[model samples]
Target: MGRHRVAIVVLSGTFVLDLAVAAQAFGRRPSVFAKIRHEPETPYDIVLCGPTAAPTSLGFTIGDLSPVEWIADADTVVVPGLEEPWAPQDPTLLSAVAKAAEAGARLVSLCAGVFVLGQAGVLDGRRVTTHWALADEFRAAFPRAHLMEDEMYVDDGQILSSGGMLAAADLCLYVLRQDHGQAYANDVSRVLISPPHRAGGQAQYAKATTRPLSGSLSPVMHWLIENIAEPLTLQQVAARANMSPRTLERRFRTETGDSVAGWIARRRVERARELLENSNLTVTQVAYAAGFGSTQSLRRHFVSRIGVSPRDYRDTFRSTPEQSRTVGRPQQGPAGTPACDAGPDARRPGPFSFMH
Candidate 1:
């Protein structure tokens, strides 16, 4: 298959880190993957498209970028955040972005880059996210858009957006996973030293409190992680922390922005995912190992959190026999096709609303 074409739109005052994130993820193929047998080469053809001699927010100039017109031929168009997102954008750039959207290219924005999508009129009525600090400004500027302020990212079919800075990596990896599969994305993550997937619904890193996890709650969290395999009840957890269930519930919501049951369920789902990817256990065995009482229970929670069945997830991520035979390390096998479409409706509820 031909490589996917990715065009990054560079504008004046572009945040260098944001640009670097997309460039690193798609522009450059990791040399480490080349030595591994049967690994798919990088499947992206990346171009930085903007006016010549564009000055960045870091006071440096990026010269000899491809022309903005090149975005019209891209399969995916990425817009990185600008240091001054509220500043007026170049009309030619906005027009090219609008045209790309009209041509059905996937639209992506990192951080304040959503503002550019908003200006291009492609974000109206679509779900999107941006830096939490810019949420109010985004809403004020584009009231028609459904702004998910708490989300680390939002995948609204053709338009995908992420929160500030590092969330760019999250969205880029997500797009990679969508285009390729879990195993391929995982290998890339290993090379980058980043998690393969952080749920888009996961909360953005906003300071909700001065003490996110109080001195009292820190130990409880560690304890829970250690005992994640056990089917511990909220009462049991609260008792372990020497607090009433009611107090513990309130504290959990305040400190973690999640209910006790919700947090535990997320942890269990993560455990199930790990086992599914790395172990040869059957579905039932994985369910029991991950603290679910039954395969039925595992399927319920897995589908709700991961948007696919446990069996399907394992099938997509499990290493092949050829991959398993490699000495000293597991090779990422062939890319798995995404089990579902990229539309938001195909995903389960956000992490905040997981079954409790």
Candidate 2:
């Protein structure tokens, strides 16, 4: 596999630690995985930059950062949190990201770096996350981008945004898991002693249960979350909530800012994602349980919200927990594990290429 270059933008007041979370996960090679593959490991090159080729932040001046061109050739670009937004990123840094995205390079930002991605226009029309305290302002600032409160991170395919420094690590581990299989990803997790997965779309932290119920319609939302896989329509949920469809729709938007259909669909997708990542259910089984009624429907929503299909989700996680093997290293046995793995999946494809 050819080495994939990474470019991490560093500016004045940039949080040094946030830089390392990705820097450490991808920047340093662990002795553990060295034995797993014989090919000389692909190197991860990190180029730290500021307004100029030389970064002035980081508590001292440093030089020789190559140019922001590093971002154009980089397979991935990571933007860590800046200290209080003191440095808005050299205009070139933001422009480079735009150029990279146009070229298909994946863009990742942690914490307030969402602001940089926002400025670069990479997050347009995408759902992204940031520290909860800043979510309100972030939304107002970037009206085009949907802001999800309290999510640990958000992986919207080519553009991934994370919650904070810790969430930065989650993003890096996800990259590891994607680039190397679960085995190598797990080994890196063991080496770092961090959990293997924290899905990008999960709230940075669960919002406090302080939201008050209005109009006695909350039970419907609860039921929807629990029965996500069933075929549900506005009339059905309206009937369950004992309200007119218009009233229910208004209430749903008022309480969740999600239309009735959008609300139910998101819950169903999240349910299926939770199970797919944490359970071993087949695409078809998980579909039925999550209320999609069929695997195709489930895959439709799965890709819409999570960016990958159900089978890909299960294949990526089968060797881990949340399956039939809990109380052991594996949470449980997988339902649709890749055929080559031989744990399950009667006709799954050979494992998807990791180095691609």
Candidate 3:
């Protein structure tokens, strides 16, 4: 297969990290896998599409960038988060983005970039996500788009959207996995020192709960997390919470947006990840410690919920002293700017924002 063309549509007021993260993920050659003969080389040809002069959020300018016309040949069209995502974008740029989508290019947005897609009418009736802080505004702005309030990312086949700035990396890794295989994606993830595959449904990395649980279910939720190691059934949970099994199931759905079993499984997987990152325990030991009955059970849940097996997760996240220092070094881009998926700044983005 030939290289797929990926055009990152960079408008004025683009978020610096959003543009750089996609560039780093899809633009770089898999140089680490050169020695492996069987690996696929269907690398992406990343084209930056923007105005003659692209203004960025970090007080820098991207000059001599390609025009919106370049999107005509793209297999995928990505819009990075804009500092002004809720404002109106240039009509010419919106037209180009819409045309590309209508021509069968896969559409992707990072953070508030979903606003651009919504403006272009590409996100209508599609499942999507944006920064958690902007969820209320996005829902009001594009009522046709089903915004997943807490998801890290949403993959609606051709149309993809991710939550917040850091979630851009998560979306990029997912696209890489879809184009290549899991092993290839994992290898590239190791090179970038990031998780290859975080589940799209995982909650956003936000501040502590300003919004409390809907009702008296807080005690049950806390107890579940505390006793995750025990093989507690729904009936058992209901008994402890002083409610019937049916009531417990309904309340769990209302308060947590998931089933009783699913919430427990996700929590256990999180516990396993914590142990893997912080302890020197064996995989079997970690499995038992996190509530899985056996190593096999741990592997199954870990792969399903966390996107990697126990050993591999530990290998990437729990590196030795020396390896840890070198693992997270940023890859160099065209100039001196470090190629990394950096997080957003502390300032809250404006509502109904759009790129210029």
Report per-prediction Cα RMSD to one decimal.
12.2, 11.1, 13.8
Which parts of model 1 have CA positions greater than 4 angstroms off?
Answer: 36-40, 199-204, 209-356
lDDT of 3 by residue, 1-356 (tens): 67799999888799999998899888855666565435535478888998898889988899888988888668999999998788998888888888888899999999989999999988888999998888778999999999986788999988999889888988988888898878877777776788876643434243323355456788888888788877677778889989998998898898889988888887788888888788866566676688775676677787765556777777766676534556667544447665322322111123211100
**Reference-based lDDT, residue 172, model 1:** 90
List TM-scores for all candidates, in order.
Answer: 0.58, 0.55, 0.60
Cα misplacement distance, residue 106 of candidate 1 (Å): 0.5
TM-score of 2: 0.55
Candidate closest to the true structure, highest lDDT: 1
List the global CA lDDT of all models. Answer: 0.80, 0.69, 0.78
> Taking the tens digit of each residue's C-alpha lDDT, what string does model 1 give over 1-356?
68889999898899999999898888767677665425645678899999897899999999989999889878999999998887877788888899999999999999999999999889889999999888879999999999988777889999999988888989999998898887777777877788977643433134332234455688998888788767677788989989999999999998889999988888888888888778866566677687775677778787776667777676666765734565654333235422221112222223212233
Clashing pairs in 1: none
Full ranking by TM-score? 3, 1, 2
lDDT of 2 by residue, 73-169 (tens): 7789888887665335567877888999999998888888888888888887998887766776788778999887656777789988888667777
lDDT, residue 167, model 2: 77
